[model samples]
Target chain A: MNSAASEPALIGLDWGTSSFRASLIGADGGVLDRLAAPEGIMHVEGGLFEAAFTRLLAPWAGHSDLPVLASGMITSRNGWVETPYVGLPAGGKELARAIATHQTTDGRTVHFITGLASETDGAPDVMRGEETQIVGAVAMDTSDGCFVMPGTHSKWVEVSEGRITRFATYMTGDVFAALRDHTILKALMQDAPFHDEGFRLGVASGLSAGSELLHRLFHVRSMPLFDKIPAGASADYLSGMLIGAEIAGGSAGKANRGPVTIIGRDDLADRYETALGIAGLTTRRAEPDIVARGHFTIAKAAGVIA
Target chain B: MNSAASEPALIGLDWGTSSFRASLIGADGGVLDRLAAPEGIMHVEGGLFEAAFTRLLAPWAGHSDLPVLASGMITSRNGWVETPYVGLPAGGKELARAIATHQTTDGRTVHFITGLASETDGAPDVMRGEETQIVGAVAMDTSDGCFVMPGTHSKWVEVSEGRITRFATYMTGDVFAALRDHTILKALMQDAPFHDEGFRLGVASGLSAGSELLHRLFHVRSMPLFDKIPAGASADYLSGMLIGAEIAGGSAGKANRGPVTIIGRDDLADRYETALGIAGLTTRRAEPDIVARGHFTIAKAAGVIA
Candidate 1:
């Protein structure tokens, strides 16, 4: 084992449903190197996560003594192992304690971080690794602001001072899938990724005529009936309807007085920015690998590294 | 056939998915008698509708000498026959022509009404028998306003003078079935129909939190993960989310500048009124049998009966 004086060693693992990435970082918070594996917690069956991880890191077998800190669905109920949920206003300590301690066949310290939870108007919402990203985002900023992390389940979190005040999760992913696959809106869309014109139109239609979104939604099916708008615009129309409604309702704009900073890919950020602009709000953008950065900040705060 | 001196004889049929009711009215507009049958268009094998109708209406077999008017699924593509759409601001004469004029197994005068089509913002919407209801509603008052005829596919129609201006259908019943049967919200509801409290709460939740409705919806599954919001409450919550969102979005609410009237059973009318109240509108009650009244109005308009 490396002494703290020599260079404390720690490994940070970002594991999710479909992929896994791990980094070996020095005590100074510098990455030595990283390894990626397609075999995520979601891909592996229960009870085999340990073996999968062992094979994944076999090349780095020499670092058997490093402390392992993991995040993502690897800790979900159906993941490698189920970790207990930590209640609202959760932080690093809560996450660390909720982590399940494990010993690999080669004898390594394995700790999976806990997910975050909060009640919105008495309804409960939870997030796993996103909490790490929030921690990093908060660490990067001195003032309080809302964080919008766009993904399958887009989360908008509020932070006051250093604590996670509250958060809400939108099934933007599910809606995307549903509209694209299950709804008649699918017919009106091109196979290509959403065009900006379509996206903009959708956002505009959603907001300007937002109150009628639901009623007008059926027209996506009825349009071809009366020989009017092309069916291909249905997908765009639906996207605009959902996102426009989100923006009009202030979901992606600001939080209690804090500005919004969206953390995602460039195109998505642009779309969101466009949506927010339409809803009359200015927003900032951040491109750091949020979960990895969040985990790094957590490891640093815990004094195990950095 | 016996006839009244001033009015022409007319037959009005309210054929629906599950049942059929035909009223034979006199030239002076009195119901000569009613005929009921189980052979809803839904039960028939499409082309067999003519044969099925002939078998059921053997008594009025001679009515072939009179003008017979029909409403309902009989005009849908899969019903008796598909009638070409009549453009908006128009009525059902072409629809009458489109009807399969069967020289029945025995001859009969059969006239089917055509569905109405209107376009808004480039999207087209259509309504079938509801045009008859709008015709009926207008007969009561020729001034411009909105008229809502609620059912499985609830139609909110706008009319001015004698023309149907615009219309939209809300899948209110479909949503009700989906929420009550397939989702976690069902856990929160009882099989038996409950009263006004939950219904009113559902409407209010939909109105204020309508934008977050989808976000709140995902929690119907996650609620049991942390706190104990009854499964039944989830049902109520979902119902509220949909109906409430509709109220906020004005699904059945009309854009016309006149009083709103709801037509349905007492319980349903109360729910709509409550939803309308939440939307900041007042409503008057109309007879639930708008179809029958619609039949009478169309007959009068066509001079088939006065």
Candidate 2:
């Protein structure tokens, strides 16, 4: 490996509630190296965040001068620095302007990216790290389309002119986990391979006109009881129903935003893609290393790295 | 208590999965004496249901000759006698005709009232205890209307000519509990007295046209964050949203089924009544002791008692 080609220019950190991931990005927008750990904001005991950060980044100690860009829940009220949320119509430049600087005890500087809040809708919706991912996605594709980030709390963001116009968050994955593991539906669910037919049925049901989710969820229980679907496939069916409902709710009035871009891991992105197809919408998966790319973009806009 | 007026004619047991309620009905179809315990079917150790029943009924051992009628999950597959479910368009007569008898160790016969199933809809739905409650409601009103039984799994039943024709189940309460206690929304919730305004706001949001539940639920977290509602009221807000969604789904096509009869305990029925009223549907509470009344009506229809 050529040392100059692999020289680290910026350290990007995606520090969320349950996991921590850091990337060493080269000046040419390439990933020099990457490291991840389970030490999220919630896991660091005794307010030892600075120590944890320093210890985790010890592998690239030779590149100590590289500017560090931190995002996710790490900037929340319970995190290392509580940054104010940037309102709608925000992107890399806006996030760069609002970036708060934290000085580590070791005389190093860390830039924290603020989250975005959507107040245009009835009730307020907010996202921390996903804003960066959206910025990264916009950087990859300059089109004005919607991005579906499927996760514990799936986000549906609308982007125009390389800035996030508005977005909505659906507790799809979180609710699915709670229902499948804690409710009466758990009795009928068994570990099984992905069932395509069950998922399609679920998506169709979720997207059905005048279908209420509370009623549709009970079908997860009744479907197996009536042998409409085998018990083993109930989990995936439940997944499809939730994802489909999310797409229905997220794309209620924004159907003309063109094809959706799914930004997440392949497994979940694939599920969202299938559910969106079932809902008669097309989708494309975003490139990998979205967080790292977002960090690099924001770092450049903030002038932290030149 | 006059002995003649309190003359026991039948023993009615509303035994369910998590609760056991037994009522002694007099010849005049009035409750003579009642007993309740936490010994639901699941609590009976080692399939010793007969022993538990005998011990629980030991208080009324002097009236042992009175025929006992058991309903609820006591007739389910996991109960003492696994009675098959009776199909739709069933009432007291149908339930009486399908009652299965089990001989206890002491040679006493316990008649288990079967549940009802609805296969008319796309998917199948079954109910064990609520069917008897509906029968009792029909006996009191004798009206062709809709019955909303709100509990862990809320049931909406369409009754015509004193028979349940079709019905649907919504996991409103169960999902509410799961989401409130186990999900990310739990962080913003605080236990407090019911907030009427918060509940009203939730109901209006839930009853909004084209509203999706997954999105509405996120408002429970956002409302507080945005200062639209206090943290203490979030619990009630969540409850109202779920109950309101239930009403939306339950009364979708049956708005003209006359006033909905709420068949449940006072607190839950009150919540359902409020949510239904918010959804522009009138509601009336069912009479207490509906289970005992149902048991007596079925016993008389089956000639188990004069």
Candidate 3:
């Protein structure tokens, strides 16, 4: 490797569905420089995933043959190399063993981390990039409980003894987007910054709404008619209700219930924390860069770099 | 009025979002003939509702000065005339009292039967067309209990002493369509006939899915991965889950524990009946043409005809 063996230990990359994020990690597991590109797994066309990624990483051409640790949708079926999801009770070690390796034309050794496949008897559940975040979060705090990572497909992971035992996936953001963009509720909501009181009320309503999520959602439109819920607050309220329902259902049978460790951006993580709080659950937030931290942890375990 | 003063008794119309259905009702409450046109409320454009409806009814020009009774979206804000929703505990007589009369230049007195508005303390819930169906269903069965009308916006209505007591609305069909057309699960589904066993299992799963509908729904994608639910069966299972959740939420705290009277088409009614049966509830379907039957009963209550 061109760089000193211990100088910059790894190049960590998190390529998700919509965006590609990378960070240069030093031997001390600290991020040196963060890089990003619009070339997410989905946006990269054809099978030119490696070429596209290489071009994006051309800025660091001098660091030859630097071992890279990649996670997220990059290891998915549509990604460069389809890495098999390791079944859970997975941890950093399980993820490290299943790392799929590839070489770019520029001779960079890229080690990709596979995700966790939930051991569900009924439905086959899986998560690609979130497992890395789990490792990163667990590494930071050795406590075991449920961890929530909210996004388009928010994940509720069960962590026990530093291992991801089981989990559930909720399409909270996807359903909300579909309803807003495609359904009539779109017309009912107004553009307004999220108000917490409205969100709390929404959580209350959603929980009381029972199992009939489809039925309760209609109230978003009707509440405005009687001026019960203002139009501007409707979006936040809807968000709260969906998130509330997700928490109620996801936490149904979990034996290890305590303060959930949330790993995400500020806005989404805060929303989930708020809802979880309202649902009588406590939560602690890991650092925002858990995905990168995860990559660093997995890469170290795989010996991709010293 | 023309046509022997009592021959065409009353002209009944069911104008909803997608289409306009009209029936010529004789004094004996029998439909002499049914006429349908694609000119639904959405199609009647440019503030020419009366004009468009007049052109469609030009075939019945002979019945000049005949009083017309209209229900459904044609009575909403976007319809020809915006009628108010009567509060719940409303029945045939209450609906008759709230009829908004209009003058269609075809020399006809159009008596529009307004819908019932649910008394939701948190949201202003209302249904324009389903109330007519409830009126008709109650007239036929006279057994006072809860009535469910499954459609684009499925409704659960309560009745007591032959009067509509209260109700709630679920966007079951709307959400189903949104997922089928807008969500990723659409790719995993196919155009297959409704499978009863699959639907039953779905209902069981949905009801038992507890509150985490947002999470359980993701299993629709994964179930096939584990060979738990087939690709074709996924659609039926998803449908069952949504419908089951609706029943669980809608039926909560209802005083009337008797068998629900479902007023809908055969397919939807049967699916609901199956789900309800699995939930340990009994159901009996009302006549298929509850909307038409409702309009007829309302027309008579309004004294627009004998």
Instruction: Give the winner by DockQ.
Output: 3
Q: Over the stretch B99-209, how does candidate 2's per-residue lDDT look in tens digits?
A: 899898888999989998886347778899888888877776687788888889988899888888888888988899899988998887887888999998888777772
Q: Looking at model 1, give its docking quality level.
A: acceptable
Question: Of all true interface contacts, what fraction is found in model 2?
Answer: 0.68
Ranking by lDDT: 2, 3, 1
Show what share of the native A-B interface contacts model 3 retains.
0.90
Q: If both were scored by DockQ, which would come out higher, candidate 1 or candidate 3? A: 3
- Per-residue lDDT, model 2, residue B62, is 94
The whole-model C-alpha lDDT of candidate 1 against the native structure comes to: 0.66
Stretches of candidate 3 off by over 4 Å are A1-6, A104-107, A252-257, B1-6, B193-197, B252-256
lDDT of each: 0.66, 0.86, 0.80
TM-scores for all candidates? 0.76, 0.95, 0.93
Which wins on lDDT, candidate 1 or candidate 2? 2
Score residue A129 of candidate 3 by CA lDDT. 85
Among all windows of 10 consecutive residues in model 3 chain A, the one with the lowest summed lDDT is A1-10
Candidate 3's DockQ: 0.75
- The residue-by-residue lDDT of candidate 1 on B1-306, one tens digit each, is 333453436778877667778777665545666789887887876568777776766778677466677877678877776777787675433333344443455566566776777777666777777777666555555545665665655677766666776777765555555545644345556654554555565576566665675566566556656544444455555565666666666544343455776766676666677777777776777644456556776666555554
How far out, in Å, is residue B129 in model 3?
1.6
